[model samples]
Target: MKGNRRSEMSVTEMFSYIQGFLSADQDVREDIRKVVQNLEQTAREILTLLQSVHQPSGFKEIPSKCAKARELFSTVRTQMAELKTKFPVEQYYRFHEHWRFVLQRLAFLAAFVVYLENETLVTREEVAQILGIEVVREKGFHLDVEDFLAGVLIMASELSRLAVNSVTAGDYSRPLRISNFINELDSGFRLLNLKNDPLRKRYDGLKYDVKKIEEVVYDVSIRGLAKEPESGGDK
Candidate 1:
């Protein structure tokens, strides 16, 4: 009966659990390269989707986002591969959606990667600069970086929540939190459509919220704050 119940569980969750159990077993291991390839392939799928669409022009038109998403997934895949090599891909209980594991896992990784990039790679001023320039700005760009980061933070916050919820609540008996994850992505996608008000003649699409954006960089902010002032303390 437990086996039957397990059969109904999520593939991803199962894989996660199984990976945990056989941590010492070397026979069922996954290759890091294979995981990376899977991650890269999915990213290409997203890029192809965008290329087919007529995206709006603007500084916010981060054309490389797809590539970045792929890279992030690749990182997670690499982690999974290592873990799987040490463990197994099936958990005793169900916690993953077998069919959608790739995408869901990718979403978490993509959001995580975005969170990191928001900290180290992109800056609010740089984002603002992108919006300020006429060539990029005129096409329809402006943003409230705050709004987007809210979604990312929400997404990251849920990772812990979902993981716990799965173990304690056994919610993985069903679909788990995929909807919320997708909602986070939707938040990002919606930002794609927002054009700064026509009367304002500013493209909100390219605008970024400094405070909200700062949330995603929580770790980086801590590091930045921890450092001594470049000039040193008061004399």
Candidate 2:
């Protein structure tokens, strides 16, 4: 009889605990909202800086711009770490949806810089590492794959502009290189089974970017300018 009574008391306590969990803490939500606001503002600033990446003379300015973006990202990571302590994985996603755009922009800015310098793709793992977040999705809050992919898509748009700008700046070979990079990126994207959402929409936008680059290349080629070697000169 004593054992039975103890079990009944445990059950009662478990129900109360569950009730508390069901309500959640409003204060935490508000705190996360405040953090999101700060992050959004910083993200906007970073986006502005990243715009320079596509300009004719903007490539040289990217390293410094990226530095500023990284500093803001550090602040974001601190807020995320705090939120992680108070919430579970799903809760993280709830708050993450609010500011994930900022993360994408920041990642895109950094990754684009790397691409400009090295003519290589910046892997998701590398972006997450630079952003000071975990790429793994074992249990708790982690970097979202969709967010990273969106950032990559954003880079595609920037590259499209860079392609046009390169020609305007008289660097035809850079657009050809960019065209190849974007083509490979597009092929890689095709392998992914995307849902009918923003990802797919962004993926569709890639075709336009490709067309713009191709037009640039074709115009150059048709004018008997295809065989010229790339001149190593700063724009």
Candidate 3:
């Protein structure tokens, strides 16, 4: 009877240990969610700044606007770094989808800043470094391609609007350059046999962006305003 009672007690203890393990897993996820939410809020603020920066601002003012957005990006990057360190073991990829929206937006903002400054597209590798994340393949996690591509799509739309706004603000050369940039991006996207549904939808929206920029270019060219479309390469 004594041995049987001991065996039953051991079974109960093992069950409790399993329950505790599951409970800890839940706690970890909850903690990650809370942090991600905070990061998401910050990312949204940065996006707002990026979206608004090109609106009738002086060229001298643009650098300040970009600087402010970069400051917020730095904070978001720090939070991401912390999350990477504390992300529950074996659950990094699983939890990554939770933060996908914010991550993609952050990626867009990083590239957008570069685009605004240099009129060039930021490469995926440069964005990964800016975000302080690795692009590991074997038994390691990397920044999702779909996320970065989504950001670029979003950038395309913004640049379309920027093209129009730049013309209004007396930067005539920018609209043609922007039109060319969108066309090039559209061509690259068309080459990909995309399987991601959300990415495909965003790629579909690229046509609208392309058309809008084309209209802007046509309007400028009809008025004899824009210079020749000589800036071809992505610097």
Candidate lDDT values, in order: 0.36, 0.75, 0.79
Q: After superposition on all CA atoms, how large is the RMSD of candidate 3?
A: 3.9
Candidate 3, residues 23-111: lDDT per residue as tens digits?
A: 88777788878878888888788777776656665444666778887788788778887777656445667777777888788788888
Any runs in candidate 2 off by more than 4 Å, and if so which?
1-25, 62-72, 82-86, 224-235
Worst 10 residues of 1 by lDDT: 92-101
Give the lDDT of residue 22 in candidate 3. 88
Q: Per-residue lDDT for 1-235 in model 2, tens only? A: 9999999999999999987865676666776677667766766776776677667676556567667767766776676676566556666666676667777876786677567657789987878766666788775566688888898899998888988877776667777788889999999998999999988999999999999998988987887665776453232
Query: lDDT tens string, model 1, 170-199?
Result: 222111223333344445545555345331
Report clash pairs, candidate 3: none
Q: What is the C-alpha RMSD of each candidate to the true structure, in Å?
A: 21.4, 4.5, 3.9
TM-score of 3: 0.84
Any idea what lDDT model 1 has? 0.36
TM-score preference between candidates 1 and 3, better one: 3
